[model samples]
Target: MAVVGLPPMGCLPIVITLNSPHGLKQRGCLDSYSSVARNYNKILQNELQFMHNSLAMFGARISYVDIYEPLMEMIQGPKKFGFDKIFNGCCGTGYLETSFLCNPLSYTCPDATKYMFWDSIHPTEKTYYYLFKNTLPILDFLLKD
Candidate 1:
């Protein structure tokens, strides 16, 4: 089994929208929220390591995949990932619209690949592709003996 860590919450469109007036004024993040994710990831990684060792006697394979740094890399370097919008979603205003709010009436961006997020809470397919790429090595290792 694979356990993935949390993404950078400070970069979430909804978080940014509610926390800042400028909203996407810069490709930056709130250290407070992001730090929480970091701390949580550290704890999760440690716990997973404990589980991995503890379960090894039973021949259980539990791996930890880190999406935090990879996502952060995408956020900090959007242009490198072919992403033009790092802080907003592809739907509606790209600020707060998510799930039910993103109805047919809410138009979507022409190119979702250009946006990191598809909605306020979910990442776009392109973002997932990059994240997958970043974690593939660990996944491959898990597949090995």
Candidate 2:
């Protein structure tokens, strides 16, 4: 089984929107939120590793896939991934709105591929593809071993 870690919550469009004094103007992630993600990921990784070891005798293979670093890299250098919108999503105002909040009345961006997020909290398909690519090595290793 493969378990994926949490992405940087600080980079969430809604998080960046409501937390920042400058609102959508700030494309960068909030340090406090990101730090929490980092710490949580570290703990998750450690626990997964322990589980993997404990289950090894039973022929269980548990691979911990890290999505946080890869997503953070994309957020830091979105242009490299052909992403122009890093701080906002493709739906609505790309700010606080998400899920049920984004309905027919909401305004969406012209191209979702250019955006990192599809909603306030989720990544776009394009972003997910990039993240998959980034985690390919780990997945490959998991399959091979």
Candidates in order, TM-scores: namely 0.92, 0.91
Backbone clashes in model 2: 0
After superposition, candidate 2 runs with Cα above 4 Å error: 143-145
lDDT of 1 by residue, 12-116 (tens): 888888886576575457778889999999999999999999999999888888898999888888899999988889999888999999988889999999999
Q: What lDDT does each candidate get?
A: 0.88, 0.87
Please give the lDDT score at residue 102 for candidate 1: 93
RMSD of 2: 1.7
lDDT of 2 by residue, 87-124 (tens): 88899888878889888888889999999998899899
Error of 1 at 40 (Å): 0.4
Give model 1's TM-score versus the native structure: 0.92
